[model samples]
Target: MHRRHFLLGGAAVMLLPVPAVADAAPRATLYKNPQCSCCEGYADYLRRNGFAVEVKPTNDLAEISRKAGVPEDLEGCHTTFIGRYVIDGHVPIDVVRKLLAEKPAIAGITLPGMPAGSPGMVGDKTEKFVIYAVTKDGKAPSVYATV
Candidate 1:
């Protein structure tokens, strides 16, 4: 329950109880270069999709990605930590939710570089995007999804 006040006149007021709302937003932490604006856009996109995102600006994004088990060649513009998995690039929230729901035994998933019309980046999509799942065992990434 919520408390609220209503003013009927200059000298009159009424108290009322308003219903409370429950908005459960999934949480994620994103790390990106300090000067990258596209990452911010991605964070906003996540927020719009009911995700509670905490974006951190850092200059050592490459080092962070490397430590997170993402290969250098398949790195994205930003890295996000959702639950127990790492998400690279401008991946859509639906895919992220799928990963969380399925709970795969991989390090995380990556969409590679800043693809056009992926999530935050600009421009129309020229081709279908292949999302790769990276593992901690140093094996080559395999296709996870296409969108």
Candidate 2:
């Protein structure tokens, strides 16, 4: 209860090692074509934003995206699965966090193609990103959010 003891205790606590939270960061598995370096950048971006991303390079990305319900023409460069949802392409971190928070009744969200200035892609952003939501029931994707 003394001032000196309180100050010392606070300083000691601050110096103690902080433990990593168990599963605090959401775990996501990202699948990309073996030759794309942008995918690695995207994975690193995700990791910096509190997502534990595991990058898996595969030649069957097209097949994986198709099986995950992403249309062939609408597939992104990389396919990431987080919990029950699939996030395709270089989607913004805020949008991904929003998708995970909202937990909508859809297969996942996608930012089709490798848009310039997307999360990991280089070049100036030419236009606003239009993210789409795809479902498992073979329905057309709808606009989820525009960022």
Candidate 1 global TM-score: 0.83
Deviation of model 1 at 59, angstroms: 0.9
Whole-model Cα lDDT per candidate?
Answer: 0.89, 0.93
TM-score of each: 0.83, 0.85
Model 1 per-residue lDDT tens digits across residues 1-147: 123333344235334444444236678999999989999999999988888899999999999998888999999999999888999999987888889999999999999999998899999989999898998898889998998
Clashing pairs in 2: none
Candidate 1 residues lying further than 4 Å off, grouped into runs, are 1-23
lDDT for model 2, please. 0.93
The CA lDDT at 1 in model 1 is 17
Could you list the CA RMSD of all candidates, in the order they appear? Answer: 7.0, 4.4
Best prediction by TM-score: 2
* Candidate 2 lDDT tens digits, 1-147: 699999999999999988688468889999999999999999999999988889999999999988888898789999999999999999999999999899999999999999999999999999999999998799999999999
Counted clashes in each candidate structure = 0, 0
